[model samples]
Target: MNSEPANRRIVRAPRGTTLTARSWQTEAPLRMLMNNLDPEVAERPEDLVVYGGRGRAARNWEAFDRIVATLTDMSDAETLLVQSGKPVGVLATHPDAPRVLIANSNLVGKWATQEVFDALERQGLMMFGQMTAGSWTYIGSQGIIGGTFETFVEAGRQHYGGDLSGRWLLTGGLGGMGGAQPLAGVMAGCSVLAVEMRPAAIARRIESGYLDREAADLDEALRLIDEAKASGTAISVGLLGNAAEVYEEILARGDLPDLVTDQTAAHDPLQGYVPAGWTIDEWESRRERDPAGVIAAAKVSMARQVRAMLAFKARGVPVFDYGNNIRQMARDAGVEEAFDFPGFIAAYVRPQFCRGRTQFRWIALSGEAEDIRVSSEALKGVVSDPTFTRWIEMASERIRFQGLPSRSYWMGLADRVAAGLALNRMVAEGVVSAPIVVTRDHISSGSVASPNRESEGMLDGSDPVADWPMLNAMSACSSGATWVSLHHGGGTGIGFSQHAGFACVADGSDAAAAKIARVLGNDSSVAVFRHADAGYPEAVETARAEGLRRPYAEALRG
Candidate 1:
């Protein structure tokens, strides 16, 4: 923790129609950066950690202050450049240029390992940005709750005959993304046992309303789970224990959970995943004292955790890797069958994602729930997908907006574009209180290359190629995104993945309208084309049905 006076506490953003910057474009990033650090949104605001292990909003307090200062005075025609959460430069550009361009945790292929990253971070040169954390679009665990709920619902449909009542889910970690699991499981009508090592993590989840209770020990946790299961009450319990140890103990017991998964920060072992035998304080200190040794221990611990999950899978229990790349870490640690279970995306989300739908979100600029309500009502009118409509309704009733009032769901190409256009019209007509900023995870078509997660089992075996995300970023930039980011080592560990992010603000102007139309259309079209090129029939059908203009689609049409 930086003890500097400017860096020691939770930072809150100015709310309600006040622009500290020259324009909303600049203010958007500024407020979002601060919002990400808000006590309600961030897991550890004092250290700038928003989620995942050390995934941070800025490299350090100095960098965070600099980025804020730069955004404050930056002209509307200027673009700010951020590298690994540090403000690097400002360039004069056109109105269409992205207001912010960011590259986080990006390393050259030869040196793209956690060891190198840790060394750089120790020297104040880099930081891990974990998915939405560094991109400045994280809207708290609610941002992740809907997707997790969908996954659980799908799991129920596949295995439990579309019913998860009276069941229990076993998982690990309570980081930013993982914290949503408990609430999602409850929403799916299942009891959840989420094992987290840190008391702070458990407290945060409880405070955020995602967790219902904390167990005193493994025995107490099991008792709570059994009680919940017996009563068929949907609830979430946080167990304070080491994941590896808890998993091994669970394996020792005969009965297996209905579903099993993990979200421990196994991707970056040295700093992300805590070793089993060490205390949290010890783990944190030893990481600095002996990073290589810490990595070795953590990898072994992860291998143990994976082996336990494998045991549950062998018992015919539903198990999946929650896109944390822990299996790869275990594999590296000599667990030959570490990947016996499939990734969550591969098992549940890929089919929908093939049609250019993944985790999508929109934030109301005014930070008012009523603004969100108006946008929601307008979105309901435009989107015809009954699934998405129900999702919006469920989310509105359940999810508590942590920072800026926001709504998120999974919608394919056509519905996404329609929703964007509808929100734009509402903004233009003053039906919505303020402009809406739309965002998506870095998992879109041509936006990510992660063999273990997003691109797992890709039809064309193009999972490891990095060109797609670069193209995705460029396409978003050309298509009028307000800001675009290209990042490495998100979801998966360093050297294993590259992804891009897009954010477009609907400001009620004609330019905003045109941008939303083009960006949303082109952004989704690229995914359709990517999937079609890979020989997915549904992607092909969607492309033909929507009359998308892409080389592959045009060629097929001819």
Candidate 2:
């Protein structure tokens, strides 16, 4: 990690000019791990929290140091075994084998609840590795911005005639993923009123340019929203108030915004959620001393919040849950109709997933914007898919590079590997400065079991079957991924989901080319197979068109 001895706090990965490890394979994991800790990439690096509620890059500082030391000295023939961010063992393996194999937050099904997980966690037995956090694949907030933008765009299409001019959106809880909502809504041409209790959270969004203004109260927030809407200007306003109370007040007045949703950390009641009437300080103190009390209070508050959201749906305004499992919390708190609204994924993202159009990210190892530009152009040159070509051009023009000058676009299985191989050739030809580090969410198809979110309402009802991600990880490692990981409790919280992820470095070598071709192709092919298996007609057509040898998919298609 890059650092000066005078100030040890700012740790970023070293960039420019060559490989430090024994080989590029070893170098990829080492640099990517440090990149995850870079101040620009991580949400809270000092605490090792990368993003989400408590998703960490490593188990602890000690573990982080050890992992770095291990990766620095380990050879390509020796594979490091990381269990929940701790490097526990090393074993000799073939060159094609992954340099690192990781399993994080895995627990027996019966013992997967938060109470048991916490006991083991405090004993240093496990850590919650939310999606890309522990897997060393996080591409910062921009990664999520694309998905959020798509949701609002879909909302506009469904309810606002494909345009959000002179429209406004109302949502709550501006934590990590939720913080993207304001910017996404504005980007889709709608003003947004985001209700968040924490002043620090509101300030963070404003500083990041995700929010345009912060209002003192609901009246001021409403005024700002109205003014922005009237001017046909998109803006985001952060309201300083409890989400539950704010939504309820709007419900009482029968003056609701055009859309409703939430991104509060309601997945974890004790830690992620703040109870109504409790100050941040009190909430923190009580979380340590009275967790049960905190959970109870938070559940009641979430119920009220969901009740108000249901009121918006009742009034015929589009309402959805932003994948925090807040509806479940409210339902558990005795609000029987809490699930009246759908999750954002179920509403807008699943169709894209069926077509294998999901978060496809690549990082510029050189950390140079020109490298990204060159690679994007290189990718655009080879692929004739007009959708992808247009997206590449639009992304390079519109999306600001965040945390390592990375870029992501949603492409299906058909052309994803084509793009990867094109970028690899560019790197080999010296058209770009460094290799592109490709990554995706841990919850890619055939690689996640989340009943409430990604796998919700599966045709075959395989949402709780946890073996898919395990199979996906094995496939990745066998297909020549530099590193492969399987994680539990990624997005929907502990015991709720299991997923896997992989990182492949494209360094412009024959070996790198072969690996990228196999990994990217197979990785995305599994998504097509997964959706085909689930009876998605589009996926079945894609599988046949791509010549994937899935007999069951063929039979199902027939």
Per TM-score, the best of the predicted structures is 1
Tens-place lDDT digits, model 2, residues 1-558: 444342366667768857767777777788788888887667778878887768888998778888988888888788999999899999999888899998999998999898998889889888878888899888776677778887898989988899998888888878767777887788778899988878988887787677789998788888887887777788899998888898899888777789898888788887787877889999989888988899899999999899989988989999998888899899999999887889877787777777766667888888788998877777776666676676666566555655678887766765678877888888889898878788776656667888877888777787677766777788899999999999988788887888999988888988888887888788877777787787889887777787889976456659
Residue-wise C-alpha lDDT for candidate 1, range 1-558, written one tens digit per residue: 224585457687777777888888888888888989988898778889988777898988889989988999998789999999999999999898899999999999999987787779889999888878999988998887877888899999999999999999999999888899998999888999999988998998888788999999878888988888788687899999899999899889775789999988788787678889889999988977888899999999999999999999999999999999999999999999998999988898877766877666888878888998877877777887787777777777767889888888878777887788788888889887767888886756558889999889988887787877888889889987988888889888788899999899888888987888888878777787777778889888878888876774566659
Per-residue lDDT for 78 in model 2?
89
Worst 10-residue lDDT window for candidate 1 reads 1-10
In order, how many clashes per candidate? 0, 0
RMSD of each: 2.1, 2.3
